[model samples]
Target: MKIDATLHYALIFRDMTTEIEASKLVNRLAYEDSLTGIANRTYFIQELENALLEKRSIGVLLLDLNGFKQINDQFGHISGDEVLKTVAMLLTKSFPTPHFAARLGGDEFVVLLDGITRQSQLDESIGFIKTKEKNFSVLLGEQSVPVEFSVGGAYRENGDTIDELLMRADEQMYKEKYKDRPHERNSFN
Candidate 1:
């Protein structure tokens, strides 16, 4: 009887351990960005949904690298990937913990800032990102290449849906891209 009880307890413990491990794996897959180890788009959307449901005011920033395709075409896909990783690192460092950042795929990233109450604070945060310099170098064979991004954002009050917020941010991002084209061309020369 004693041996049976011991075996039963051991089996229960093993089952519990396995359950915990599986839960952790699911959470990791759901939340982590497979490429850069930042949060993924699913995680970002979940958080944004929660914030909106709770009637929270927030700011969403969408960033797309200008001339990213040029880098991929001129250097190669590997170089493009390195530039993306470096940009992700810069974004994670720039934003705070309560604020979430994620790569929305390709060269575009999204940042969601919760509990924002004022336009000035939002402006300050946007200004901070605009001034950040991504100075990382990617090695293509024996050569080093540099890259940068253009960012734009939109603020949400209490009732905006995810699609609406993303659309506004994307539109603003396109405007910034167009505005920077002159300087972008100049920099290549």
Candidate 2:
């Protein structure tokens, strides 16, 4: 059977469109966080590795949300999820293009700042994040739950590998996280 030329082209276009949409959905599912809509850990790691391969000056800002478990306990997971989404929105807004944010599971989130040639730029980014921490709070059922967090950042030094960079940043983050906890400090000390 012969088909009309116009109809044949229209069918081809529709098929192409469907394929494109399916590809997009697959990519999103692979590289995006289901809850917060930010880059998933896999995407973040790949991007970081690419930046390192390109020898770009980059910094990693690691953040851990304080009292997140309490929020999950007191307000429940739904409210906790809302808080995570809000934080992701703020991170995306604060660190636009050339910088990437990812949720490294739970209350841990990270930002990869690329093309950072100066310390001031890193300082500026961290300062903005700290400011956000000061003003950040979520309202749940007439109660304001402050979204407090501890952030630590590490700039890539010469000959630094991904693990080394991540470890340094993680160590700094833990230091910041536990600095306020005297009771727990003795165990580590």
Best by lDDT: 2
In TM-score terms, candidate 1 sits at: 0.80
Clashing pairs in 2: none
Candidate 2 local lDDT, 54-120, one digit each (tens)? 8899999999998898899999999999999999998999899889899999999999998776667
Provide TM-scores for the models.
Answer: 0.80, 0.87
Residue-pair clashes, model 2: 0
What stretches of model 1 exceed 4 Å from their correct place?
Answer: 1-12, 15-18, 134-144, 180-189
Best by TM-score: 2
Question: Which regions of candidate 2 are displaced past 4 Å?
Answer: 1-14, 118-120, 182-189
**TM-score attained by model 2:** 0.87
**Residue-by-residue lDDT tens digits, candidate 1, 49-158:** 88888878898888888779999999888878888888888889889688878988888898998767777777787778887755555666788776667677878865
* lDDT on C-alpha atoms for all candidate structures: 0.80, 0.88
